[model samples]
Target: MPAITVDDVLVLPRLPRLDPAATAYRPVRRLITAPSGYEGEGFPVRRAFAGVPMPELDPFIHLDQMGEVDYAPGEPKGTSWHPHRGFETVTYIIDGIFDHQDSNGGGGTITNGDTQWMTAGSGLLHIEAPPEHLVMSGGLFHGLQLWVNLPRVAKMSAPRYQDIRGKESALLTTPDGGALLRIIAGEIAGHRGPGSTHTPITITHVTVQPGAEVDLPWRADFNALVYVLGGKGTVGTERRPVHTGQLAVHGPGDALRFAADERQDSHTPQLDLYIMGGRPIREPLAHYGPFVMNTRDELIKAFEDYEAGRLGTVPAARVPHSHGQQPPR
Candidate 1:
């Protein structure tokens, strides 16, 4: 038999409900966004990737919000000329469009409800800009970009891309009304996601209606987090109130249980969230600006290579600002 890839052994852990009080819940850290303070015509809006300061959330580095922009006609705001290493970026767009170009010779536009997965292996360069149509219309542009660290063995692997369409991804509807689970890279309720991944991880976009409760089983060996995009709910028995832009980290356990309030009927409070967790690398992380490497020597070499003009692969120039101008919150 041929050697097995990490994907071969990856199986979605069984979903089980844990007692929040009994299991011991860890405090979820809140990451505050700071201005990118970039000084270039192409810098677009103040951008910040959430991974740097929140390094305690190991294995996962950053989570960035692009926008909820309302653009005017013929206006474009976005970013240009960035490099990355030793990590993977997963961009999920809820509204508007994004033109993406990269040093791996990959370039394209991802519209509303699209997901783009880019792995910056040994090294990669890319740019993301918004489109003119949405900008001119002043439409709502909202999206998220998450960074997953690469294990040392795969740090120098070749870069790759997987563009997953909204329709192609798997969706699971709970028996209870108004609850939906969108599985992007992992499994939920026995159904698996469609995208390919380099690591053993689970990514799900979950929505819970008022009075509905859902329980998910996960791995005890992996680090887990729940990011509340909107609405409110309690994880396990903690009954903690979660709001938009807040992240909650759960303790290592076999499952996660979420319960919605049962009393409110007129307004079914919605819970829009992403449940993500993965095996921790536990290795030294050396990150500077946009690049992440396993050692100081490797990081220094990356800079030398880029300055020497040896990292020359470039994606085709794309339409500027197809996605929007707002940076990651």
Candidate 2:
């Protein structure tokens, strides 16, 4: 909720209104409520992309809404060392702190609306956890982790990392100054975010005030999706009702329409949304656990590589705790 914001939205650049007669607004194709689940040492999460067909979620495989949880002392949890290949992991923190370390010497502490992007293009070992002090004191934690797939041509690219601070996002407002848009990656209205991507995509976080609506221009060729992070709202021109933990997939169009309800719960003063879309890869996908590939043989090779320690060794510092903790296939 404390992600980048402004004292007065009217001061920011506003989205230009589009012609109603010419603008083709995307229609809501499906609405799904995410199922609750657990991940990485028992941290609570919501499976944001569950029950959706792969073609509809092209270039994106998994998404987890991590904790709106307030942990008691000693209750904090995190992932043990693990391996991933052929994809990217994007962790965005809205209200908490997280420390991350990968075998590639990419590790840091990010908190209060920061993001840690890890691209396990070929393969790598990584660990994510709370700092020791936070584990002892406990506090609020809320965030999201999204898995983005690389095209076949880039599947074997070298792993990389990008640390994006919340302030680096491009901030904009709706025409009436009733909503805020934070562009995290890709471009919107020609204003691009700080993230660099191998694929063409756009990821934005939207916060709408009560009774506010926004008609956003989108790429006609890219897929469109919106997921509710919290609060209540309606998506698309049909105004299909949506609330927290819901995801809406939209049909082809040149724009999207959504608005927050006039009344919101006390706990949620605004309608928070995570919107993303990308050009579909459309390539054959063979996936198993953390490895995503184009063929079953490629998947088998991935597993074999990991077991054979060709996926990179766990850092010497973590050998003590990461040994024998290989994630089950």
Candidate 3:
């Protein structure tokens, strides 16, 4: 999970040390473990937001943690061309390579710590797969793909894309330097990430050293969630035990808190977390498959559009995809 690292976290901006007495830390409202599944041409994925309520996940709809698996030669898999409407897909590569291209002309190869931000406003067709060389000589592949819902007004807006590199992320540290924070999007205590989002949100990846704790000030208006990528830890003010593939939903508060256990398996020496929060859109949501709209009719229209070739068609010049797969009917 070497998406980004610092030789000395002390050199980064330190999070404001809040007075514990005054800080209203969020309480863990729910904790759920992600179930493993296969996605897109047989690549493994963990559904990170499984069992979470949609209202609580407003502004953000879905999440998938892609393989932390080592692929043998010719074993890398990827999604075939597909269509999505009324949302954006944020693909962050933590330790592998992924190539993406959409009909709206947004995409490229993103490697360790790189992020592919694709807005499917209105609608578009896209494909994601490993590069040809990677497919030939497979190696480690791990990453996350988060679905961010667009507001009704922006749902039909023009599509766009942003290729964000890992080095472009804003780095911060806990007051005690026990943790490293990589802010991928949104504002955190006057610091902002590079991702230009239609909705206000914050996405961060935190690495906590063993026996260390962290307190992150959060927007009171935003809903919070913490997901463990690897290792063991306790979350929230209640110190609820959490482990790999677990997600913790937090109640309203002005800050977030979690800690790493003193001992962890050698395979995972540090506690890794992907934390995200966003101002709730709180709109009527109608979602089915790749479409996220505000009404059932709209979702039906999205499917109709795709079938009618309104969403988009696969580019003739696109590089080869996994096994020459086609869009699912």
| Top TM-score prediction, candidate number | 3
lDDT digits (tens) for residues 35-105 of candidate 3: 99888888899999999999888989999999899999999989988899999999999888999999877
lDDT tens digits, residue span 42-154, model 1: 32232333443444567888776554445566554667566777888898877677777788886577876678898888777777766656556655556778888988999
- Clash count, predicted structure 3: 0
Model 3: lowest-lDDT 10 consecutive positions: 320-329
Question: Which predicted model would earn the best lDDT?
Answer: 3
Clashes of each: 20, 0, 0
The TM-score ranking, best first, is 3, 2, 1
- lDDT scores of the candidates, listed in order: 0.66, 0.89, 0.92
The reply for model 3, stretches above 4 Å from the true place, is: 324-329
Off by over 4 Å in 1: 1-56, 74-76, 260-269, 313-316, 321-329
Q: Write the per-residue lDDT of candidate 2 for residues 106-183, one digit (tens) a residue.
A: 878888778899989899988888888888899999999998989999999999999999999999999899999999
TM-score of each: 0.79, 0.96, 0.98
